[model samples]
Target: MEDLDVVAWIQVSDGRMLAVRSRGRDLLYLPGGKREPGEDDWSALSREVREELDLELDEATFRELGVVRAPAHDQPRHAHVRMACFTAAYRGAMAATGEVDEYRYVGRRERHLLAPAAQAALDLADRHGLLA
Candidate 1:
């Protein structure tokens, strides 16, 4: 089985975390993407955020969030994925690039628009007093 390694940015602002929805995908996902070869977590996340949202990651404000491993929700069961998540500050306008069609800040809800892993990150953010 092939492995996919990615880094996600958990961005919280105004008591909500950022979530992105692709044009046809039902589930919202944290803003991130796959890492390039030889890139570390921070570098990969920075690149992804820039590519996806046209924003620059504030490295000085970055923090290491925990990682998540699960079967690739979009791929076959034989394909597993590992996510190295992080939190950072950004100072630019938001735009949907790559696969993202829309973006919004999500708060606590009985049902999340995001996937399980993204929901888990929201849970963590809530526990950290970052969510409404």
Candidate 2:
């Protein structure tokens, strides 16, 4: 089995986390994407968030939220995704950009509408007393 390495942003306001849906996809997810070769977590996540949200992530304010290993969607059955999630301060207005077409804030109860990795991330948040 192979692991898909991904980075995700977990921005919560009033107990709801930021969620996004990419173009041509049905599942909603947290901001961020697969990490490219040679990129550290900060750089990779920053690049992804910039592309998806048109906002610049402040590396200095990054705080790891959690990591989740979940079944990979649209991949081989044996493949899984390891998503490292974080919370960070950012600059610029938040807008759906690049591959992202929709953005919303979601609570734990909305987990059923999220992608697998995002669902796990939200579970982690709830475990940490973040959403409740």
Candidate 3:
């Protein structure tokens, strides 16, 4: 059994949170990714958001949302994911780049469109009153 650790950005707007589909992937996920070796959560999330969304997160605006755990999507049955999540203000327009294929805002009714980890993040955001 392996645990896949990642850092995620939980950006919500107009009752929806930002989600993305990586190239060649079907499930939509939060705009973040796995942390690189020796990288802390802030740096990892910032780097991932920059790579996937083409924007830079403001360190000053960083806020801890919470962490979530779930079965790793599209991975082995025993694989699991532990996602450290946060919210932050960012600079520049957000557009799909790097591994990202499409980016959009999704609400609860659209939950089925996301990966397990992302679904967990969405629920966490809703609990924090960040979503409608």
Residue-pair clashes, model 2: 0
Compute the lDDT of residue 45 as modeled in candidate 1: 88
Q: Between candidates 1 and 3, which one is better according to lDDT?
A: 3
Cα lDDT tens digits for candidate 3, 1-132: 868888999999998999999988889988888788899999999999998998999999999999999989876644888999999999999899998999999999999999999999999999999998
lDDT (0-100) at residue 70 of candidate 2? 91
Winner by lDDT between candidate 2 and candidate 1: 2
Question: Against the hidden reference, what TM-scores do the models get?
Answer: 0.87, 0.93, 0.96
Model 2, runs deviating above 4 Å: 76-78
Of the pair 1 and 3, which is ahead by TM-score?
Answer: 3
Our model 2 lands, by Cα RMSD against the true structure, at 1.4
lDDT of 1 at 50: 89
The digit string of per-residue lDDT tens for model 2 on 1-132 reads 769888999988898889999888888988998778899999999999999999998878999988999988765654788999998989999999999999999996788889888889988888877785
Residue-wise C-alpha lDDT for candidate 1, range 1-132, written one tens digit per residue? 766777899988888889998667888888887878898888888988988899998999999878777656565643766777789889798999987898988888733577766877787777777877
The order by descending lDDT is 3, 2, 1
Clashing pairs in 1: none
Instruction: Report the Cα RMSD per candidate.
Output: 2.0, 1.4, 1.2
The candidate scoring highest on lDDT is: 3
Clashing pairs in 2: none
Clashing pairs in 3: none
lDDT of 3 at 104: 93
Candidate with the greatest TM-score versus the true structure: 3
